[model samples]
Target: MEFATFILAAQRGYHQSSESVIRNSIEQAVASEQAGFNTAWFAEHHFNNYSLIPSPLMMVAHCAGLTSTIRLGTAVCVLPLY
Candidate 1:
C-alpha cells in the first residue's frame, strides 16, 4: 500500500510562532520523504489557526527542493478565498 502524510501546520496555542509552524511543516515533508512515504499532503486555510498555510501550492513549491521523490499535494484549496 502507498503511504502518505497530511501536514496540517496547526498551531495549537499562541506559544508557537507562525514561522516555526511553517518550518516544522516543511520539515515533516522532508522527513516523510526520507521515511519512504509516497506523498505529503498540505492543508490550506486563512485568517485562522486551523491551518497556517494560506496556499498549499506555495507550500508544495517550497518543499519541492527539499524533497527528492515523495509527491506533494494540497488536501483542499478554497478557491473562493483567493
Candidate 2:
C-alpha cells in the first residue's frame, strides 16, 4: 500500500524567498522524505503575490537533490497553461 503526504512549496517571488526561506523549504523536504512521505507536491504560478512558486519544475529538480526516497511533482500546474 502506498501512503501519501504533502509539502507546500510557495511560489517564490520578490520577497517570499530569502536565504532562510529556501533553506527552510529544503529542510522541510528532507524531513518529509525521512518521515516516509509518498511525494512532495509543488505548484506553479505566474506573477502574483497569492503564491510564490513560478517554476515548480525547477523546485522539483532542486528538491530532488536534497532527498532520495520520496517523489516530487506539481499540483496546480498553472504556469504552463497560461
Candidate 3:
C-alpha cells in the first residue's frame, strides 16, 4: 500500500505568517518522505481562509529539491477560479 499526505498549508494561529505556514508545509513534506510516504499533495485555494497554498505546482517545485524519490502532486485545481 502507498500512503500520501495532503498539505493544506493553513495558518493555524492569528500570529502565524503565510511564510511560516508555507515553510512548515515544506518541512512536513520532507518529513513525510523520510517517513516512507509515497507522495505528498498540496491543495490550492484563492481569496479564502481555507488554505494558504495558491499554487500546488509552486509547492511541488519547492519540495522537489528537498525530497529524493517521493512523488509530489496536487489534490485539485479549479482553473475557472483562477
Query: TM-score for all predictions?
Result: 0.95, 0.69, 0.91
lDDT of 3 by residue, 1-82 (tens): 9999999998778698888888999999999999999999999988865799988888899899999989999897878865
Prediction 2 TM-score vs. true:
0.69
Candidate 2 — which residues are off by over 4 angstroms?
1-3, 10-19, 79-82
Tens digits of lDDT, candidate 1, 1-82: 9999999999999999999999999999999999999999998878999899989999999999888899999998998877
Clashing pairs in 3: none
Give me the overall lDDT of model 1. 0.94
lDDT of 2 by residue, 1-82 (tens): 7655554544356665545555666687778889888777876656654445666677789989888889888776764465
Rate residue 36 of model 3 by lDDT.
Answer: 96
Clashes of each: 0, 4, 0
The parts of candidate 1 lying over 4 Å away from their true place are none
Error of 1 at 68 (Å): 1.0
